[model samples]
Target: VSFGSELSNRAPTFDMDLSDFMDGDKPISYEKAKEYFSQDPSQKWAAYVAGTVLVLMTELGVQFTDSMSILVSSSVPEGKGVSSSASVEVATMSAIAAVYGLNIAPRDLAILCQKVENHIVGAPCGVMDQMTSACGEANKLLAMVCQPAEVKELVSIPTHIRFWGLDSGIRHSVGGTDYGSVRVGTYMGRKLIKCAASDLISQSFPSTPTQSCDASEEYEKYGVDLLKSEASLQYLCNLPPHRSALPY
Candidate 1:
């Protein structure tokens, strides 16, 4: 599959030649592409383009000799908490895969797009945006679990109900926002909680125990392991106000 682009009065200009990007008669390296994209602000989409090429090259174990062109026109507003980047990344990946005759599954393709966004685009993002864009069905909502990265359920929207997006007129970029710091803060919070629970356990259970200690007391005791368990975190998040000890 080959892509060709010609500039006209009514068309957009997009023409990229893979052969022209050779280094000493060999294909340009990913490192060189990364460096070139990193140095230019006008080539913001260069990372995504390089990411698509690199992923396809790695998967196929062959250099792309043909030139490809992409002309994108979208009405969707950029930023504003919307997934403009993910859409672009997914589209780019799909186009490249289709042109290269690579049979990439939707989920796998989404994962690749997420990796490109995170590593190449310098945006710390989860797979939600890419996955949804790739796998979403019409008139349905996708429920997903991020930890293991699986779709739990798909619920159909009621016919009577309509959904529409209203631009808030505020532009926000994930890289420019405090989103990365928020994620770091959450991890740090979990670590602090685990440490505190461990300290509490050490203070409560010493090597020398009282004579009153028995099976019943052991059954009632909650160890640090239990406190640090996954279930414990869920419980803490959902605990009732009266029973909750941790501040929000």
Candidate 2:
């Protein structure tokens, strides 16, 4: 029930091949997909799972009755940790909600979308990506409150700061090895913080309807503990920088 553009980048020489899953055992390399119709096994597996979930949700009337649905366009790239996958998922959820004439709150909708991508799709993404994409205001950077779907205006970008994107000659698959592990690490970091400074997340993210047990001042009172909780952040940050996963 989802609609989108062709998966492959079109060229005069040949039509790019597209895979329909993520097969961890024997992933279909990009080279193979580009050269032959045989799909990227890993991506094919993911797509199959995503497609199945979307169908079931749509059937259950989530899209038809939710106000959070709104139509939007996005060009987030996949893999490399740039959050394009979450972007598309949220965008599609927004679209379906729009089609159904639902009126759900934006923040709530963002949380739901994140859950679908992480839990339902079998990925271990953080709430930040989906929340940022959903709450993003054009020309501004969202300083994400990782837990409880809270975000604050970090700063606004120059209106004239035109962003240019460069695609690397190589593209990595979202379901490629280690990608999920990175996401899982980030999630664990948030949970670690949540276990102690629960209030920090609650006050910042009231729209989520969850209360934190610790306040920001209380969290700062135990600054060393906060630092220790975030120690695992390095793993998430150490991923190779690539075009597809850039924050911009």
Candidate 3:
């Protein structure tokens, strides 16, 4: 698919044009967006860039399978710490699964969504957001203990619930410097943790320490939380100047 935008001198204007993939070649150009509309300029530009691929992917699946649920209640709400990006991703994956008539269990769908973030959007995110969004059972907290990738159980928290955020009225360019830095920080933390785990196990033996904790236990006990904290701090340190970033 190819998308382009033309800015008008007097009014807000943008347009999208698309085409099909040839049998043996790539169909889309992964270039960045440069055009702008006057009134809703900045966010519009971001939305155009972000939502173009989102919409294209959503519609293609819906069209192929004639399923309206592919696009059902699917939108990324901005300025909220509630992970609109993950929501959009799960929506896309859910749509694709539905359209293709795939038998996808909830937990498996969550994993698939994580893969999309890791591979498609090039985000080094944890399974938490996508997992919860896709496989969330109402009135419960999903205990996603990270190592062998299993949803252990859900704890109930019954109360009148509310969600809110203090959005600083600041908009961020997600694919810009900050996003890349966060990704790099996350990668670094992951590498460090993996190395630490290996060293720890090697120390247990005369030649090398054998793993006492099962991989699952190590993942749940030390791996996930350690990496998350380290990555968040590293990301904060790496954020760009003049950019106000927040964490969830």
User: Top model by lDDT, which number?
Assistant: 1
| CA displacement after TM-score superposition, residue 123 of candidate 1 (Å) | 0.4
Show where candidate 3 strays beyond 4 Å. 1-76, 160-164, 168-176, 189-206, 209-248
Model 3 agreement with the true structure over 1-248: per-residue lDDT tens digits: 11122221112333433323112233232212222222353334333223333333433432331313222232354434566667766666666566567667776766666554543343445667777787777778888764445788888876877545566756553445676777666655654555455545454434753424323335445654563443233322222232223221
* Consecutive 10-residue window with the lowest summed lDDT within model 1: 1-10
Residue 240's lDDT within candidate 3 is 28
TM-score of 3: 0.50
- Each candidate: what lDDT? 0.61, 0.49, 0.47
Q: What would the TM-scores of all predictions be? A: 0.70, 0.49, 0.50
Q: Write the per-residue lDDT of candidate 1 for residues 152-239, one digit (tens) a residue.
A: 8789999999988787777677655476666555654664554455444445576522222112233226754674362235312211
Ranking by TM-score: 1, 3, 2
Clashing pairs in 1: none
Model 1 steric clash total:
0
lDDT of 2 by residue, 97-148 (tens): 5666666566776766655554345455557777876888877788867655
RMSD to the true structure for each prediction, in A, is 9.9, 12.9, 10.4
Which is better, 1 or 3, measured by lDDT?
1
